[model samples]
Target: MAEIQEKADSGKGGKKRAKKMSVHLDMTPMVDLAFLLLTFFMLTTTFSKPQTMEINMPVKPDSEEDQSPLKASNAFTIILGDDDKVYYYYGLVEDKPELNTTDYSANGIRKVLISPRIKSNDKMVVLIKPMDVSRYKNVVDILDEMKITDTKKYALVDINDADKELVASKTGG
Candidate 1:
């Protein structure tokens, strides 16, 4: 708000002189506008909540070693390799078990994870083995797939010698 107040020719030699004026500015509307903008931003903006994934880790045995062993029949092994290559097989690599190749797509790993065999077996466990040549993104992708499939039982284990030999025989490395 603005206003101009005129003083009635306050000069001693008042010979048809112009009126002296002073301007007054009110800041109430500016403050109201600021508050309105603040409230609008506060109400419309979305606050980010801290998101965390629940990781199930095996507990260390105090007296004896880990007694409960993972069942072989319900194991689903996934191997990540170079050039975004993904391989998988059911159970252990028993002298060159067919290493099926798949990608990190909806039709690739997702379909395999949500297959009928996996869904039917309630105790199905996923074993993710990332090779030295594979990128960290591959492991993250597999973990995300596990989350998508609602899988509770899974492990990130190192590649064994038998697995390496099987892979070498298949890839002719």
Candidate 2:
């Protein structure tokens, strides 16, 4: 709603001059409508739910006899270290696993994970060992890469002494 007021003043010669008018605008109703719309939208809209990645952890064996050995040819190991360094090997470390270094880029670890040999092997497994010096985000990113590469079998294992030594020798730690 709006209103206009007019005022008349007498000139110096006693003649009446043109009326001066001022306009006022009422914004209370408009403000109330805006608030009501905001509340309605807020109440009717649905918020996004949190997303989570599913991880399958292995169950502990009851005895040594219950454990099964994994084949070296079907294994791939990834070592995560500080400064975004990634070291990978094709098979068991006992066979003198030739450590190759790569990064987290699309053409780096992803390329290795999706290679024809690894992808075609039905029993292929990925072993991820995150060192103490590695950042939390690096672990998460590696996990995400595993998912993106659609690796069916992967495990998060501890950094062993041999692995620590290899990393130390390679990175000059």
Candidate 3:
């Protein structure tokens, strides 16, 4: 009986002196997850290029009674046909402008006018009025023409108020 009690006390003391096991988490998987998320965001991010020009549009007039005027020297109205053709007219919007006959010939519309009013400094504002069935290519071509013609200042006119039939009658495809 004394041997059994001595064995029991020794076993209890040995159990009390045993070292405890500690748990540690591995950080490799967490680091890998962070790198993967960073790569995904880098691949999905979009970069933007700056615009070439700074265009300022005119504000709308207060009342129908008031006729706000646009500068004649810096204005043009471009007409596009359904068959991918272009025509241009220039002057003040308030003055009911007319296009020069020499500007357009058998070849196509001319680039830049040599008139007393139009100079290098004076920017021509272009207003495009496209036909209903006009091709997108035609519009682009007209814009390119505007760029080529030294007519940097331009805008697209809404066809809702424009004469649609006149726009449809431009020559050549």
Candidate 4:
């Protein structure tokens, strides 16, 4: 609501001038309406739900001896290192594991995961070993890559001494 008032001043002489008008705006109603709209929008609008990646881990057995050994032929290892570098090898690390370096791009790790041999082989297993220097996002990116490639069998394992040695030698770290 707004109100206008005119002020009349009596001069020293008898000369009369135009009265000055002042306007006062009452903003209580406007403020109340604004707050009401704010509350209504806050209550009605929905916030984005937190997104999550699903990872299915194997159940632990009662005895360590009960676990079966993973076949080297069916295993594919991916090592995550610093500087967004990825190293992969087929089967186990032998005298000289044929390690190949790649990035997180589609033409890199994705291509290797979807290769004819790896994709066609139903028993193919992906072992992801993230080094201490690797970022958490790298692990998430690799997991997303696994999902994108439709890789069914994958495990997150600790980087072993052999893997460390191979990475050091290949990366010249």
Best by TM-score: 4
Candidate 3: tens digits of C-alpha lDDT, residues 36-155: 999999999997888554445766779966854567666666666544555556664345555332223335664343344444545555567776777887767666666556665667
Measured against the true structure, the TM-scores of the candidates, in listed sequence, are: 0.71, 0.78, 0.44, 0.84
Query: Worst ten-residue run, lDDT, model 1?
Result: 63-72
Candidate RMSDs in Å, in order, are 3.6, 4.2, 11.9, 2.7
TM-score of 2: 0.78
- Candidate 1 — which pairs collide? none
Error of 4 at 121 (Å): 1.8
lDDT of candidate model 4 versus the reference: 0.92
Candidate 2 stretches with Cα past 4 Å from truth are: 1-35
Is candidate 3 or 4 superior in lDDT? 4
Model 1 has how many clashing residue pairs?
Answer: 0
* Candidate 2 lDDT, 82-170, residue by residue in tens: 99989999998878878899999999999999999899998999999999999999999999999999999999999899988888888
Clashing pairs in 4: none
| Predictions in order: lDDT | 0.86, 0.92, 0.57, 0.92
Model 3 residue 145 lDDT score: 60
Q: List the residue pairs that clash in candidate 2.
A: none
